[model samples]
Target: MEEEPCSLVYRLEQKYLNDDDAYMDQDIVLTNFTGSSPCKMASKRALELVVLNNANISHLGDVSQVSGLMQHVAEADLAWNSIRWECVKSVLKHLPQLRTLNLSYNPLDGEIAVDLPSAPLLHTLILNGTNLSLTSLSSILKNTPCLQELHLSDNKLDFSDDDESVMNESVKTIHMNRCRIEDWAQVVRLMRRFPNRKTVFLCENPIKSIVHQTPVEDLSTLQSLNLGKVELIFQEFSQKKLIQIYNIIDFLDRSFNDTTLEAQVNH
Candidate 1:
């Protein structure tokens, strides 16, 4: 069992944070706060990290019903619940200091293009398993300009059209594993647009086969690219009876480079 946070020992508000300082008033957890609104308690205590996840809450208005814990909150885990985009925007109104939000595992497929709250402090957003598209995604990016890390894995993402992802330079890491994207041009567009993208996860996407064919001319900023599962990709081709294995050697030879490539050079 987890040690019940060693009781809040009232220490004089001092400059140096030592072992004597109690961790009690630091976090307010109500994962099982089933029939009660915990934000009132959070507001009363001015908690820093509020975890209301798995609380069977339909809308974030439950928190708005009771006031208080808005100014001090830095992290919120509202994942694994029935939350919509509007509810999240309402959450931003109270949690301006919020940096990380976990909205994963929720079926928020209907919400689209809802205006984001003005929270410059917000940096990370976890939207895993949410059926997202270009239109809904653009709406979110339009509202939040300072997002640095975005997670949109396990969704149906197809950027075959000429739609450009409205991602800011602040965003450096993108996780899109198993998104089913088949367009290499869309992937190239993302790489060209984001000047600071250090890590990109495109594994298990349909666009893997085209990587060898597509000239990655604009991926100078990319440091880590997870395009593994070569066996799976080849097996997928075999299962579909699309191409013969004899072309595999040709594919490898064309993608290999004898000289170190410049960031701007064509592959």
Candidate 2:
């Protein structure tokens, strides 16, 4: 975890990181590129995957001038960097063939909307710890409609007073782990918005009081649901409310188990 002297983004491994060249040229997978120094990368040809994990990248200062460094990149991991929200758009703009992108641990406080629809091939996006809001996130996802999995874990998303918004069609799995959501009504709202959604990770949310009537059909499409560590009662609930809670728990257990079995068979 020492400060690395200025180096090219491509030589981040072996020469640095863990001093292991295992990720040098393994079918476009890069790894162990941690440092507090700026990154400058240049190659004769375009690479497929580029990982700049924990590189302390701020505003993309190092490789701002590098032209076409990752034109053909399919997967790019820029996690654990303090990258500006504006710079994310520039990074994606540079890589047309990008399919997977990880921008976690970047505090993107402002409403920075990246034109993700441009990359039709992009499917999986990870924005954990980005502090993305419900409204801003909806705008972002509208462009990335083809995404299959979207990760927004630890983003501090407050949905207690949020209204329902439109969502992507292709997104089947959504991770909202530790988002601090308190109201169960908001959860129902999300289910309504994303009817095609198969999995929802709501672990560690401040969810309680499911007394309000929730239709069974509202969450019928859900295949996997993670409500672990979520409280279900606050005050003395009516018997009707307890019945609704039982119904949800039963549905989640049965539906998720069935989906798991199906996945296992397919794999």
**Highest TM-score, which number?**
2
The lDDT per prediction is: 0.58, 0.65
Least lDDT summed over 10 consecutive residues: which range in candidate 2?
258-267
Per-residue accuracy of model 1 over 119-162 as CA lDDT, tens digit each: 78778988888786656766676656788888888988655557
Superposed by TM-score, candidate 1 places the C-alpha of residue 192 at a distance from the truth, in angstroms, of: 3.7
In the range 1-267, model 2's lDDT, one tens digit per residue, is 866432334333322233234544443432333343212122334456777777666654444434455566788888877676566766666677888989898767677655533557779999999887677677767767578899988887766545665577788888887887777777778767777888888877766555446766777777777766544332345667656766756655674445431110010
- Global CA lDDT computed for model 1: 0.58
Report residue 230 deviation for candidate 2 (angstroms): 4.6
Q: lDDT at 60 for candidate 1?
A: 50
**Candidate 2 wrongly placed segments (more than 4 Å):** 1-42, 61-68, 113-117, 160-162, 229-244, 251-267
Give the clashing residue pairs of candidate 1, or none.
43-68, 43-69
Give the TM-scores of the predictions, in the order they appear.
Answer: 0.67, 0.71
Measured by TM-score, how close is model 2 to the native structure? 0.71
Which residue pairs overlap in candidate 2's backbone? none
Q: What shift in Å separates residue 114 of candidate 2 from its native position after superposition?
A: 6.9
